[model samples]
Target: MTNLQKAVILITGASGGFGQELTRQLLEAGSRLILTDINEAVLRQRVAAIQNEVKTGEVLACLASDLADVQGCETLYHQVKALDIPIDILINNAGVGLFGRMDEIPRQRWEYLMQVNLMTPMRLSALFVPDMIEHQKGHIVNISSLAGWCAIAGMAHYSASKFGLRGFSEGLFNEVKDYNVKVTAVYPFFSRTPILQSERFGTLAKTYQGLPEHMITDPADVMRATIQGIVKNQLHVFPDPTANRLHLLQRYFPQLVYWINNRMGRSMKHG
Candidate 1:
């Protein structure tokens, strides 16, 4: 079991609903936290709120840095390293979503989503994995999405980013398993997070409006499952029931999965 007590964990996008919930749960479990987000004020506010409640583990530092650029990723890494704290666990939770047709979505937005969702994790992992290897211990959690496994309309770029992340996480897991470093890829279905408030392009707003609200998972439940996965050293985590069932179905009935997604897309387009 991974002992979080006194373990230094760095969580990106700590101000978001899922990220904030994860921060609270991890702190309650006695993990030292170094939280980061693009919005410094909001990140620090969340940190203060958690400290006011749990008051157990240390909140090492709450630094805000944009992770959508390589320099930003490097800066965050160096900032943490300068503090002389060995990050025992790194949670790559920062991500953004752009909803629209593949052709209609601007290239700039697609690149931004890819940078934040895929490249940032890869960059951070590259920077920290060596240290974990030298110590022969550490954990990295990449917050991928259900879209990664199953392609869906109106989320082409977002799905691509997550799919890349899923592959990277799996490859990293194999590469580091022998060295005792664990890489967990979390595939959560839509959650009731601010990410749902993502910018909608083309006809995405109309499509999203037709989606069932009940389908969205709870951030708290997702965070609970994530912490459990981390402790158990799970390589692939399907936290939500919907995602788990879909993942199994995709494995057993690939054609059925494609048909369902195609049907959903048609319905959204017509509705």
Candidate 2:
């Protein structure tokens, strides 16, 4: 794989756990990043830290915008064009999660998750694909999860969003492969991130109750795997060993996976 040195990359959710780590690695790898997140203050703080660390690699701009609204996505496109920064890699990493049974999660909350996790990526891809086409080179990386392939009780909505994202990423990959544009969808297992605190998964909640902090993978690992995938132009990336094993199990012994997941769910609930 050829090096994508100083590639202009746009990352959403720049203030969150994975986003922050990703920014750090991209800077270290000599990539010019345009960071954006809903939280303006955190975004500013992240950008400042990166600026202080690297005098040479570029930190293009940090803008604040909510990606749930389609109009906001349109505004983001306009803002990027106005800045005249060439976006060589687009990381659709902004997403939210809800941990509840299908009927337990509120309609608005479910919709919001869908908007952020599934819809926004497609909207941003649509906006950027033309430019990539014109330039005849680009890469799109969608951050998905292990939930996308396997079912987890109480996280129905969250799983649905990731499952949808996986499908979208796969379809987009095929569509753009002939255009000299590469697309990679990543699936990772549980990580020590703020998103875990944001969800209320009935079964997983119990398991997490007494879990050691070190048991979860670090956000930096996720960031590193994502970067490695983009650099290698891989189609599917499993960022963690556990996530990779689960994915493999799902591929060949789905019934066994179902049994194992169900047993785990029961154990968590009973614990």
Per-residue C-alpha lDDT of model 1 across residues 105-208, encoded as one tens digit per residue = 88998999999999999999999999999999999999999999998888889999999999999999999999999999999998999888788887665656
What are the per-model numbers of colliding residue pairs?
A: 0, 0
Q: What's the TM for model 2?
A: 0.93
Which pairs of residues clash in candidate 1, taking residues 3 or more apart in a chain or in different chains?
none
Which runs of model 1 end up more than 4 angstroms from their true locations? 266-271
lDDT of 2 at 231: 87
153-252: candidate 2 lDDT, tens digit per residue: 7778889889998999999999998999999999988888888777664435544442244547988987798788888999899998988999999999
Error of 1 at 121 (Å): 0.2
Q: Let me know the TM-score candidate 1 reaches against the reference structure.
A: 0.96
Candidate 2 residue-wise lDDT at 182: 92
In angstroms, the error of model 1 at 217 is: 0.8
How much is the lDDT of residue 70 in candidate 2? Answer: 94
